[model samples]
Target: MITNQAIEELVAKECERYELERSGFIADRQAAIRELVAQTGILPESCSLIEFAEWKERLLNDWYTRRRFAGFFHRKSEKRCMFRMVKRLLQNAVFRLRKKQTELTLDDELKMEEGRTVAFKLSSAFFEGFYKKTCCNGTLFVSPGHLETVCIDELSLLFPLKYPLLYARLTAKDNEFWEEIWRLIRRFVRFLVVDMGGKEDTEMIQEVSMETVLSVQEQMERGKLEQITSARHLLNSLQMTGRNKFREWLRTESRKREEILLSEEDWGKVEQAKEDRREVDTCGANRRFDYLLDIDEKDEYEVCCALVDVLSYGSGKVYGELVEGREKLARAMLLLYVENKPYEEVVRILYNTSDTSKLVNLRKSVSRGKEYLKKRMADLIKLYKRKGEVPFATE
Candidate 1:
């Protein structure tokens, strides 16, 4: 029987010729596949579906194959794919995750199976080379590619597929000085300040206490405008009027009352509040929020800012090296295969396979590589509890 991989490739390949010369996304996908195949070339001349499947079976054997592809459709909470939204901004957070590099395909039958698995034996030297050559102090990730015998020092860097949307909300109206962080607000505009280390300068609002933040909401609520029913009206309200001077002066006096400066623990409380305002699903508890920050906590800021920028900007000597490492990851697609011998073969030689009994060693190597990468990814995330701090932290 034809494997799912074969079916997909065949369908895409055949469909490309009939449709294409059309304009739009469908045409773009066809062109992308054609280009990839042209650049990477087709499978080995004799790599037929049955022979490949048979080779896969031998490589995994009954013991391992049963676990990896089996029960793939089980109601395992994390494994099952789900949909989430972020209103007017980008929807669907590209799930940054890691999984085993497997050649076998999964569909109806394979999804229904249960618990067949395989493992690989990786060399310690390879691990060291993988991290050192590919990363810079947990900031950058090396490019991904397999079946290459090259050292990490000889890797290429890869960038994110797209730049994440980041914007600092401008609280002050008619302010020409605060022009730098004006992002295209596809969603509702929200203004709040963050204190990674300093107070707001460009476009960022000055950090205020949690009590003041809550008090602002309460004041709006007493006026029967808790909904912030109109964006323009809220902005106008924020501007001081002649009659509003008295209340504004009162705020200034009360602000002096807060001048004692909160204790460190109390400060941590604000940090935690800021985090919660983002509505991030940390620790698995869902708390409700009705204020401006809670409703429009910018998701794009955290991941792209804290993670991607720091990795590139902070890596003194390793920046170029990380780029090379990431190039390997960009080339991977469903049907691509790397045939290479062990350490003796040159890394650039795509079709070099070691003198082995069969495909068993290749699968084992993939299994080992998957586990090693997954563990390292987890370790790197501990440095930053927030997803915005690191690009691949979500993985």
Candidate 2:
């Protein structure tokens, strides 16, 4: 459990330490930032106008980390609740910075939620380590039941590593993403040195003044962010010409006028469409399967069981039959084809293997599974067709 007294004491100790080292570190950081600005000339390009420059400076100084931290932890009691507030502080700071950087006039929550969902889903889809169910509100977690080091700045680093798919999509737009990256760096430095009192420890503070902060900043300047961005761009280009692109290209080139890349918002729509179809299928399939098998469906899992029951109805109880495997294959077929997932992604997700040979074998299995499903499910298909219905409902 956490209490207001503990929080206030923490804040007081942190603020006192910050106040002691504030002047020197602030001077060092602002000088380092200005030196970088002078050297790279990136700042003036973004803030060409005098007003833009002044506004950017005001944003830097007035964005007090102490106030933000206190505003979140002033009265929080539960440790979990206090940590959640910490996460919120990180989120809100990033959201505010993004709104300022892009000048996007949309609702903050709307923008933040979309961005978070995109990051979460892309990480889950591509990275074997990232689990969507386990992530806390799209922020990175050290492990299950622990979420200590989840700053938005860390996410800025992690997203490019794991959420490259979304990064590729965003990079295609003519937006100020690089400028946002710079702002993220600045915000991270401010949060670390001033807000969080990152150097309050015993030895490191005495040994190296602000080298930790400056090293990270220097690393960022040495093309790290650009490297990450360019790598994603190259990968996306390769994917465009690779096997993944062929099916989509064939589908779209015949009818569509432009190349279609899935953006974050686009992926959100795709997931929403899946959910909507799942609901309709749950209702219709429950009714149809009940009529066919004389059993009631209680949930979506039961609906899947009903489908698997159809697959097993004619299977022999003989040896070496692989009855359960075939039933699982049938379910995978429905999820792959009926749910409209890309074959590569479905294979990647189900098998958790990126081995090219295994993927090739899985792709072949999917084709065979589809044919088997068509043959075995002819009656159900005919029933739906006669009723003028599609498997997954449109709209």
Candidate 3:
């Protein structure tokens, strides 16, 4: 019953509306990106072309990853690039309105009970409100029970959970800044709790919370160093290259771990270890699997950075060996796998050869790469098991 003219008109109208909506989203995203760049000091514009491209990839991956958990209600608004940003703005407005009406009132008298331990109930909604009101633009992944005790140690874990992408972006010197952010959040929480009750009543709770954050940050840093050390030991064991190489690697890595303190020079060795891990799968199954598994754990932002590192640094390494001097192999991998670009477009960009011959070869390489990655992961899992390291298990 629909005429061709009517369909064309409808399509035109839809296109016009989409363009208007997209314009608004672009403006908001630019503003947010500006703030993020300033805060993190990772200026893509100031960086070299290669660094800028990697930064762009990281942002694109982050945006894609956040979309997964953003639910329909958040995505319905075509006026923002990030659903989390929209949600934060909405929460901020609502909280401001509520603040004007009254102070933070408790749901029950039990919350006001004068016991030595203050019984504070942490809710997801309240956490969102707090984060929004404080203007902490970083995305969070905390359950309602995450702040059950508000212990400083427990609160420090929030930094890692709240900003996994940011955590991955940090260098050694930048890592210390987490303590400052942690302190800010802790103070914000204390202000809210104290506002709800008398300062005298909340003083002890605030002190305890501060202590918790400090202790937790220390523990987290220590654990990170241990993990890096364990990875190095495993890589050394792999160098044996024989029947019992895997077993020997595990034993040696654990035994020498405490003795081997990493100096600045040793960091390069660690990066080489990661490259070896990537190289384990010759045809390439394990690399893809490793990436997929990490994406699930870290969301897209961290995964994108990981991809950039591999592509940028893996030259003359395992990935280079497989591609056999195909200069565009890394770009091809990013376009095909990370960006999920179409075959025709990828070929055009990668080789300017959109023929079936190249397409077939690219497809085969991907398939073989995945197989190789899986074999590598299997070995990785075994090594983790031996060292009591939590392996990135395949789904």
What is the TM-score of candidate 1?
0.18
Residue-wise lDDT of candidate 2 within 215-319, one digit each (tens)?
A: 333444564445544433433333222322233323433433331223345545544533443343444442222232332333333333334434333333210
Candidate 2, after superposition: displacement of residue 324 in Å?
Answer: 10
Instruction: List, residue by residue over 142-252, the lDDT tens digit for candidate 1.
Output: 111111112212321211111110000122111221121112110012122223324443321211221233333345446544444333443344332211432443465
Candidate 1 has its poorest 10 consecutive residues by lDDT at 82-91
Please give each candidate's TM-score. Answer: 0.18, 0.23, 0.18
RMSD of 1: 32.4
Report the lDDT tens digits of candidate 3 across residue range 1-395.
Answer: 22344334433442243332343323343344443343332453456779865654454335424533223223332333333443443334344433343333221211222321111222244344444443233323231111112222333333212223223322232433443434443444454446645463443334334443444445456764234332223222222222132233235435434422233344455456556655434443344324333333223333334434344444433344334445465566657554558766887887788665466456546545534533443444344346553422111
State the C-alpha lDDT per candidate. Answer: 0.29, 0.38, 0.39
- The TM-score leader among the candidates is 2
Those runs of model 1 whose alpha carbons end farther than 4 Å from true positions after fitting are: 1-212, 220-223, 226-228, 240-395
Quote model 2's TM-score: 0.23
Model 2 alpha-carbon drift over 4 Å, by segment:
1-78, 102-364, 369-395
Query: How far is 279's C-alpha from truth in model 1 (Å)?
Result: 61
Is candidate 2 or 3 superior in lDDT?
3
- After superposition, which runs of candidate 3 have C-alpha atoms over 4 Å from their true positions? 1-331, 384-395
* Preferred candidate (TM-score higher): 2 or 3: 2
